[model samples]
Target: MSKSDQLINISVIMSVLIFVSAWIVGLATHKLPVLTTVLNLVVGLSIFIYWLQKQIRINQHIIEGREIVVLGCELIVIACAVYSIVFKQWNGWVKGFQYIFFGIHLSALVLFLIFMLTFKMNKLM
Candidate 1:
């Protein structure tokens, strides 16, 4: 397969793995909020590392400014989500913020998929 196809496959696999692992951890540690939060943080960091590795494979010359900005923002959101999970006391507002961050994180992933598909399609044409 082409590099783009390979990258896309890897991305999808990693995403699924992350989601499954998180769900499993949540189920296994249902009584231990701390353990669940830490495991989720590890999964989140793994995703960031995977993303960084993929970014490194791209040509630096073609990297766009907005892409970097969006990535930075996503990272911040992830960090906030982790922090809130670990530090904030469980309450209605904390739960709301967590959901908001989760939404941002998923939306960012969708945007990234769209960007990658468009880029690959443009290269083909």
Candidate 2:
């Protein structure tokens, strides 16, 4: 009903849509490295844009220290994901474990970002 509630709902829907679309693209283009790379890049860029929009919307009310901490953690998570993708090579159970670890890390990062946004909103209200 409220503006913030509407924003939250929209954010949730967009997140799901992004994930599903990305998964579909990844599945469809798995055999073509170039197409897969382009699609994955598009998905990554879209998610980044969504994150940037949310950051700008909620950041005005957050304190400097909290903002820095949130950004730092986000960077770390991004770095870890990139490092895993670029540097790590594994097969079988090791690959499965790596994916599980990455999934957990990504989920935590998303939850943290949402929590930060909610905290900022609560403070503003």
Candidate 3:
């Protein structure tokens, strides 16, 4: 890989590690939960944007169909997270919606991981 690509990968990995560690520490200490949540949301949104831009640039076309739908769901989950953080006192309905979006986010994450792994394996073979 090129130097710049290597650098970007390293930086992304390091930041993820730092965030994960901070999240774990926050949970263990029962402190900084809000801060960690905010950080996680911001990072997740940033990564999504970065990946979208990279895909567009590399493919020279807009992402469509299933990718677009998944991206929309990801955005919804981020919005729900922000809403929860901002309101901090959700009613039953709001909480239910948040839970639904959270499930969508988890499913999207797993689906993307599987796609990536399969693509890599296909490339290797």
TM-scores of all candidate predictions against the true structure? 0.44, 0.39, 0.54
Clashing pairs in 1: none
lDDT of each: 0.57, 0.50, 0.58
**Which candidate number would show the highest TM-score if scored against the true structure?**
3
TM-score sort, best first: 3, 1, 2
Show where candidate 2 strays beyond 4 Å: 31-80, 88-98, 101-125
- For residues 33-92, write the lDDT of model 3, one tens digit per residue: 454445546655976888777777784665679877766766765776687688883545
Could you give me the TM-score of model 1 versus the true structure? 0.44
lDDT of 1 by residue, 1-125 (tens): 47766677578657655654655675587623433344435545766787788778877646588867856755664675577665764445544554454445545566766666555552321
* Superior by lDDT: candidate 2 or candidate 3: 3
For candidate 1, what is the lDDT? 0.57
* Candidate number achieving the greatest lDDT relative to the actual structure: 3
Q: What's the true lDDT of residue 58 in model 3?
A: 83
Q: Relative to the unseen true structure, what is the C-alpha lDDT of residue 40 in candidate 3, on a scale of 0 to 100?
A: 43
Q: What's the lDDT for residue 113 in model 1?
A: 60
The residue pairs that clash in candidate 2, if any, are: none
Q: How much lDDT does candidate 3 score?
A: 0.58
After superposing candidate 1, which stretches have Cα over 4 Å from the reference? 16-88, 121-125
